[model samples]
Target: MKANVWHGKNKLQVDNVPDPTILNPRDAILKITSTAICGSDLHLLDGYVPTMEKGDILGHEFMGEVVELGSAVTNLKIGDRVVVPFTISCGHCLSCEEKLYSLCENSNPNAWMAEKMWGHSPAGIFGYSHLTGGYAGGQAEYVRVPYADVGCFKVPNDMSDDQVLFLSDILPTGWMAAENCSIEPGDVVAIWGCGPVGLFAIQSAFVQGAERVIAIDRFPERLRMAKKLRAETLNYEEVSVLEALKQLTGGRGPDACIDAVGMEAHGVGMVGAYDTIKQAVRMESDRPIALREAMMACRNGGTVSVPGVYGGLIDKVPFGSVMNRSLTIKTGQTHVQRYMQPLLERIQKGEIDTTCIITHHLPLDEAPHGYDLFKNKQDECIKVVLKP
Candidate 1:
């Protein structure tokens, strides 16, 4: 099988790799039918992550068919079409029982982290690096799914791949982001970063009953998507986001703020989107922009939710702003399993077309092309799925 391998900073290689077989009684082998690149993958691609040994497979978001299942894997069967959650977890762990699958204690020991927790380090990641669980990912022809019974969800046969694929990651992550905001029916929410996750957060906000959603980003296509979805958009290029938001909100700010940009936010410090902050905390920062914006725009005591991924830290956050505003901060990766059934129901009801975000599709052998387009934001690409 050929997989997208992260060789180094700004370097990706399509390499032939070995196929996977069931390694545990709870595991299954999946034939990756469709896979997409995520922003977190960029961290590894740009060398922002550590211990990325050469030839590490480089993808996490995907859906596939079960080719083989271990004897103990009772919830799934061979020939079942399923979407694999990015987090590899044992179903019975304390965290897993609580639906915090990302924090599962028995998560793949051989996958990413041998000595850390989900909120810390590269504990368990797919094909990106060795610091993560060192697990080969779905960018290839075959992947070994650890904790298969709990990790893979069967995709409805009538649904398209794009329809159910995001249930693997973004849909749930966006839900996590929106839920963090504690949105009320009449609340207005502001989101920074128009990436797929950010877009999902915007949609999720509406689903959660936010009356107004203000999506902030510099990208034209993404901003347009926000408008089409009936949300207000801040270009961050045309006018001052905070000032404009404050003016629009009657000087109070949004009711809830979400930072989907994470550490990748551009033009920090409000000096215009071009002025980079002196230093950035290299971890999840729905804070830098959304937190600050929310403090200034949210109606005093609004909530701030962060579903963006972050790691290895530095720099001090403006804790005072958040404290003075009495802002609530919610942050985490999606506990996808818990939200899957509900989200699937929504999809079945024609609520949101999650697959509409897919801007490109390529053969699994062209995994490199998908990565290039998605990494550079080229081709107006928001998401690119590789098909086997």
Candidate 2:
């Protein structure tokens, strides 16, 4: 098998690797057909997330056919096409019973390491880092899936891979972010970042009954995509984002603000430079530019929904404003299993076209190039799908 292996920061290579075999009674092996480069993958690529070792396979959003299955996996068999959620969960846990799959206690074998960092362990994530379970990712020709009966969602025969692949991560992530907003009828939602997740957040906000959405980003192509979804656009580079939100909402801030841009957010002027310097000197692990703005821009008593990925401690968070304004903060790794079937139904009904954000397609061998393209936002690329 050939996989995209991580060597070091800013280094990746397509290398031949041993094929995976079923290691657990609930495990299965998938022959990957389609996989994608997610925004969070860049965190590993740039060394933001810790515990990533050399030779680790890198990708989580993937779908494929079951080439083999273990005896305990009664619900699926050979030839079943499935979309595997990035969060690996055991079906019988309390967290799983409560439908908070990402918080499943039995998934991460590296839980103690995570406990040292976050005080508690979340679910193990495929191909993320050693902080999560070091499960091999699906960015290869084939990979093993643990707790297959719970993690793998069988894809309907009628839907295409491009239409369903995102169910593994970003689509459900966007939906969950919007759901966190607790949008009311005729309410306005503001979102930062115009990347894939941000674009989906814009669309999902509309689906959740938001009367209007405001999108913020510096990319013209991404802003255009938001416009296509009928969201008003603001280029953060062109105007004061706080003032713009104030003016747009007629003196009141937006009802909710979504920070879709995670730790690597590009800041402007001294603030941006400060985060850059702090991160470079190991004073901080993440840049909270978007989060700070979201907290400040949200209306009093409103929600601040974060779908973005943050790997470690951040500096200078505006806790004063969040506390003073009584803002409700909601965020987590998406409980993908909770939303997969519902969002798939939406795709089947043609309510959400997941294919609209795909901007580049590459062979699995060219994954290095694909990563470069997405990381740099080159070629107007919004998303990159790799065919294995």
Highest lDDT model number: 2
Full-model lDDT for every candidate = 0.76, 0.90
Q: What is the per-residue lDDT of model 1 for residues 1-388, given as tens digits with 9 covering 90 to 100?
A: 7778777667777787788878889889998888888887876776665557777787888888999999998888789999988877777867888778776666545433433322343126567465557788888888998888888898789999888999888888998889888777888888888889988888889988989988888879888887887888988878888888888788888888787876465222111111222233243434235445545566678887877666443344567877887877788767778888899998898886797788888987787777788877788988888887
Whole-structure CA lDDT of model 2: 0.90
Cα lDDT tens digits, model 2, 1-388, are 9999999979999999999999899999999999999998988898776578899999999999999999999999899999999999997999999999999999999998777667799999999988898888989999899999998999889889999999999999999999999999999999999999999999899999999999999989999999999999999888889999999999899999999998777322111121233333233323337988999999999999999987665657789999998999999999999999999999998888799999998999999999999999899999999998
Quote model 1's TM-score. Answer: 0.90
Model 2 segments more than 4 A misplaced? 266-288
Q: Quote the positional error of residue 93 for candidate 1 in Å.
A: 1.3
Worst 10 residues of 1 by lDDT: 266-275
